[model samples]
Target chain A: MADRRYTKTHEWVTVDGKTVTVGITDYAQSQLGDVVFLELPSPGRTLGVRESFGVVESVKAASDLYSPVAGKVSAVNEKLSAKPELVNSDPYGDGWIMKLELTGELPPDLLDEAEYKKVTEAGAH
Target chain B: MVDFGGWELPQQYTSIRNEHLAVRKVAGLFDISHMGRLVVEGPGAEASLQWLMTNDLAPLAPGHAMYTLMCKEDGGAIDDLVVYRESKDRFLVVVNAANRAKDTAWMQEHLAGSATIEDHTKDMSLIAFQGPRAHELLPKGSSKTDDIPYFGFRAGKVAGESALISRTGYTGEDGFELFVDSGGVGEVWDAILAAGKAQGVLPAGLGARDATRLEAALRLYGNDMDETVNPYEAGLGWTVKLGKPDFIGRDALAKVKAEGARRSLVGMRTEPGSIPRHGAAVSHDGHHVGTVTSGTHSFFLGHPIALAMVEGPSFRVGERVTIEVRGREAPADVVKLPFYRGSARSAVAPAKP
Candidate 1:
C-alpha cells in the first residue's frame, strides 16, 4: 500500500516504493464541481518540491497543479486530456496526475491517509 | 455556492450537472434575486427612457417588454436590460446585479422629466422557472390571460402572492420571471419547490444559469459585451432601431453599422478535446483576430464551445479557424450563433423547420 500525504492547496502525494504519485485531493475536485480540461507536464521533466506542474480548468475557473515532492517527472496521466471528468469522478485512484521518481528522502510533513482525512474533515480544502 | 459579483449565490442546490440536465429534460427554478430592478414612473418616464435606451420603446404597448441595450453616448453598451412597459407612464428596468447601482446613477444623471427613479431590487426578489415544463409547474392561472406571447408580461399572483410574471429568461427556454416582494420570497421559493417537486424541478444556481445561457448564445453583460463594445458589434443589431425618432447612441450605432465595427460576435466550436476559455486569443491563419468572450463544455451538446468577437473578415460558417487554448493554438470552426436550443415552448413551436 502507498503512503499518502496532502498539501494545504489540496494536492495529494502517494509514495509507492521509489515512485510518488501526485494528484489533487477529492475535496479539491468537489469544490471545482467539474474538471473540463487538464494540462499536464511532460514526462521526464525535473521538478522541485511544491513546483507547479500543470493546470486543471473547470467550467468556472482554472487552478494550478503543484508537486508535493521534489523529483523528476517519470510519467503523466494521458487519459485526462480526453476525459478530464475522471479527475472529478476518481481523484485519488485512476485520476492520479503524475508519477515522480523520488530523488532524495521524502519530506516529513506529508500526512498519512488518516491524517489527510482529518485535514479534509477540518474543512481546510 | 459561489461568489458572483459579490453575491454569495448557490452554484447549485444539488448538483450543477443534474440541475442543468433537469432544466433541459424538465424544468429548473432559479433564485435570481441578485438581479436589480428599477422603476421609472411618472409622465416623463417615456421621454427619459427614450433618451437612455436604444430600443424603440414608444411602440411598445402596455404589458410588453423589450430586450434593450443601455449604452453610452459613444455607442458603447452600458448594460443589456429588459424594459417592461407596465403602462405608458411606468416601466420596469431589469439590470444586471453588478451594474445596478452604477446603472441607477447613470440614469439618474440623465433624467429629463418628473419621472421618479426608484431601485426596487432590494425590495423585490426575482425568481425564474424555466424549461420545457415551465407552464406545467407554474401555479394555475399564472400564464398570461391574453396573448401576452413571448417577450411579454402580465401582473398576476404566484403561490397566492402578488407577482409580476414575465415570459422572459436568460435561458432559451419557455419560462416565467416572477417579481415578488422580498419578505415573501422565501415562502414563494418553498411553494414553487414543493409544487414542482413531483416534476423534478431543481433549484438551479449560477452554474446551471451560465451553461444554459451560453448554449443559447445569450451575451452576458460583463463577458460578451461591455461599455467598450456597441450593441451592433455584440450580435444585437436587430435590437437597434435606427429609425427611432431619437435616442442616446443612435448616431454612433448608425455610423458603426454603416462603416462596420472593428469586431463582431461569432461562435466557434473547437476539436473535441480542446476547449477554449474566456480571454483566450482567437486567430485565423496565424494572425490574432479577437478573444474568446465565453466558452464552456456544453454537457447537452457533448463538445467544447466558445463565443468570440473576431475582427473584420469574420470567418464564414464552416470555415476553419484557430483559437489559442492554454499556450497552443487549436483548430476551431466558425458557426452560426446558438450552439444548442432547449426544449422550451418557443423552440417546440417550430418556426417552419
Candidate 2:
C-alpha cells in the first residue's frame, strides 16, 4: 500500500496484498480533456498485464484504458455513469477505475514515481 | 493533427472540453484561414452567381451577404457558401475549406461572361473571434461589432492593419470573422490575444470550433453534407430557392422538392449518457434505419448529441431511436436539430450596407 507503480500507457496501479487498485494518471486525464463515458470491465473479468480493459470517452475521442497488472476485476467504478468528469477533476483519487485481485505477484516491468515522470516527459513532446 | 479538408491541423490545443467551455464562458479565437474566399467581379458578376447559387441573390443589395448552396447538375450539393454583394459588379464568396479547389474550379468553368474569378484563400487569413463576450474583446477599429451587423462585412482597420471584418460566425454566438493579409495575419491574432487576455479569451483549435458549431447545429462540409448529400435532405432546404428563375440543379431540385426525400437529417440524444460516434448505426424499434454522421458530447449541454441521416418514416421530435455506440445498440431519441443555441450571432441585427 505504501508504493505505487505506473505503466507506459499512463495507468497507475497500487498493490496491497493480493488486491490492486488501478486508474489512469493525472497526466493522462489532463491530456484526455473531459471524461464523459467509461466502459469499465465487469467485476468477474480477468485481464493480462498490458491488456486493454476498457475505453474512456471524452468530448473529442475514445481512448483505450490499459491494465498495468495481471489480475481479475474485483470491482468497477460505478459512479462514473453519472459523473465521469471525476476522472478529469481527480484522476488518481475519486476517479480510480477498478479494484483487481492479483493473479500473480505485481509485474517487475512497472515504473516507480520518478521513472514514471521520465516516461510522461517524453510523451509531452 | 486532424485532416480537415486536406489541411493538417491540431484538433485541440489544450483540451476540447476546456476549449469548448472557454468559448461559452469567455471568448475563443479560431484560425479559419483554410476557408476559401473567392471574388467575382465584373458586369456579369451578379448574373453568374444568380445562376450558380440556390438562394435568392437578386434581392441582395450592395454590401449584403446571404448563405446559399451551389448544387451539382444532379441536385446533389457542390458546396454550401456565403455570397457577399460588395457592389453591383463585385461579389465575394466564402466557401468551405475542403471544397475550395473544387468550388473555384467549378465556378470558373461555368462562367460564360466577362466576370473575373479570383481565389483569395492563399493571400488572405481568416480569423474568427467567438463567444459570449466577443463584442467586448474584439480589437477597437472600423470593424467594431456596433458598426457591422450580423452577416455584414466591411473593409476596415484591424490591429493597425487593413482588413475585412465580417460580423459572422458558425458558433451561434456573438463574434466577428476578420480577413487579413496572410503576412500580417499573425500580428492580428497576437493583437486580439493580448487585448482579450484579461477577458478570458483562448486561442482555440478545431476541437472547440466543432463543438461550438455542432451546438448551433451548423453543418460541417464533409461530415454534415457532401457531394453525395442534397441540400433539401440535409435540412438546408431554406438555402435553396425553387423560384429563382433558372439556377444550377433547379429542375432536379424542383422535382426532388415535389417528391419528399427518402432520407433526412435529424438530431439524436441518447440516455444512460452513452456518446455516439461517427458511423454508428441508427435504428428505430429494432430495425436499422441509418448511421450517425457526426456525434460528440455536448460539453455545453452536459449530454450527448448526434446528427444522423435516417431513412424516411420521418422521425418526429421526441421519438425514440437507437444508435450502435461502440458495438452496442444504445437508446436515443430523435430530437430536433440544434440541441443548443448561444447568444452570439442571434443578437446581431440584419446585415446591411
Candidate 3:
C-alpha cells in the first residue's frame, strides 16, 4: 500500500519515487456534498506548496483545490470532467485528481493517516 | 450542514440525487421553517397590502393566496412573497428567510393607515409535503386535503396540533404547506414521516428543494432576482398589476413596461452531465450577453438545466446559446420556463396523449 500523507484542507498525496499522486480525501468529498464540476490544472504547470492549483465545485459551493507540495503537474485526471461524482464514490482510487513530478523533498508539515484523523476529529464539532 | 443566513441546516439528508428523485417519483417532506412569515392586520389591511405589493390583492378573497412582489421605487424587487388573504381584516405574508429583517423594515417604512405587521417566523414551524404521492402521504389534518383548491388554505388540527394547511408548494407538485406552532411541530413532523414511509417518502433537505423548484422554473429571490432585478426582467411580469391603483413601484414599472426590460430571465438546458453554474457567462454568437442566474443538474431529467438572465427580449425560445462551463463554452438550448411538469399541473384531469 502507498503511504499517504494528508493536509488540513483535505488533500492527500502519496509519493512513489519522484512522482506523486494527489487527490482529495474521503472526508473532504463528503463535506462538499455532491461534486458537480472540477477545474484541474494542466500538465507542465508548476505549483508551490499550499498554492491553489484548481477548483472543486459542489452544488452547495465552489472550493479551491490546493497543492500539498511544490511540484510540476505531470498528468491531469480527464475522468473527473466527465464523471465528477467519482470524487464522492471513490475519492482515493479513480478519483485521484492529478500526478506531479516532485520539485523538491516532501514538506515537513504533511500529516500521516493517524494525525490527519485526529485533526478531522478535533474539527468535527 | 451549511449556514444559510445564520441558520445551520443540512444540504441533504442522504444524497441530493436520491432526495430529489424521491420528491419527483414518490413523495418528499421538507422542513421550511427557515422562511419568514409575517401577519398584517387592521382595519385598512387590504388597502395597505394593495399599495405594498405589485399584485392586485383587491380581487383576492379570503381563504386564497397570491404570489406577489414587493418592489423598490426604482422598480427593483424588494422580495418575492406569497400573500395570503386569511380573512377580511388579516393577511399573511411569507418572505425569504434571508430577507426577513430587510423586508420587515421596508414594509414598516411604508406603513400607513390602520395596518400593523407582525413577524411570526420565529414562533412558527412550516413543513412542505410535495410530489405526486404527497396527498396520499401527508396527514389529512382537519380538512379534506383533496377539497382544498389551489392557492386556498384552511385552519385546522394536524397530528393533534393546530396548523394552517395550504394547498400550495414550490416543487411544481400538488402538495400542502403546513404551518404549526413551533413547540408542537415535532408531533406534526413525526406524523407526516410515519404516514409517508409507505410511499418511499424521504425527509428531504435544501438541495432537493432547489432541484424541484428550479425544475418548475420558480424564481428564487436572491439567486434569480435581487434588489437590482425588477419583476419583468425576472420573468414575473404577470404578477404585476398595472391596472391597480398607484403602488410603490407602479410609476417606475409602468415606465419600464413602455421602455422594456433590459434583461430577461430565460430557461436553458445543456446536454446531460454538463452543469452550468451561477455567475457563468452566457454568450450568443460569440458576444457576451448574460449570466447564469440559477443552474443545477436535474437528477430526474438526467440533465443539467439553467435559468439565465439574458439581454433583452431578443432571445427567443429554441434559440441556442453557449454557457461557459469549467473554462469551456458549452452548448445550451433555450427552452420554455419549466423544464418539466408534474402531478400538480395534471392532477385535476387526464392527459390527452
> For model 2, how does the per-residue alpha-carbon lDDT over B161-271 read when each residue is reduced to its tens digit?
888887788888878888899999998999998898887788888878988888788888788788888888899989989987799999888888889877899998886
lDDT of 3 by residue, A57-107 (tens): 777667889999999999989999888888988999999999999997999
Model 1 lDDT tens row, A1-125: 45567887799888788899898988899888878778888989999888888888877667888888889999998888777888988898888888999999887777777877787789852
- Model 1 docking category: acceptable
Q: Which pairs of residues have clashing backbones in candidate 2? A: B173-B344, B173-B345, B174-B344
Query: Residue B46 error for model 2, in Å?
Result: 1.2
Better of 1 and 2 by DockQ: 2
Per candidate, native contacts kept equal 0.28, 0.67, 0.33
> B102-185 in candidate 3: lDDT tens per residue?
999989878778899999998988998888887766664545566677788888777778989898899998888899999999
Give TM-scores of the second chain, every candidate. Answer: 0.95, 0.95, 0.96
Q: Alpha carbon lDDT of residue B200, candidate 2?
A: 79
Instruction: Write the candidate numbers in order of decreasing TM-score.
Output: 2, 1, 3
What is the C-alpha lDDT profile of model 2 across A24-112, one tens digit per residue?
Answer: 98988877776888989999999998899999987767888899988899999898878888888878888999999999788899999
DockQ of each: 0.40, 0.55, 0.33
Ranking by DockQ: 2, 1, 3
Supply candidate 3's per-residue lDDT for B140: 49
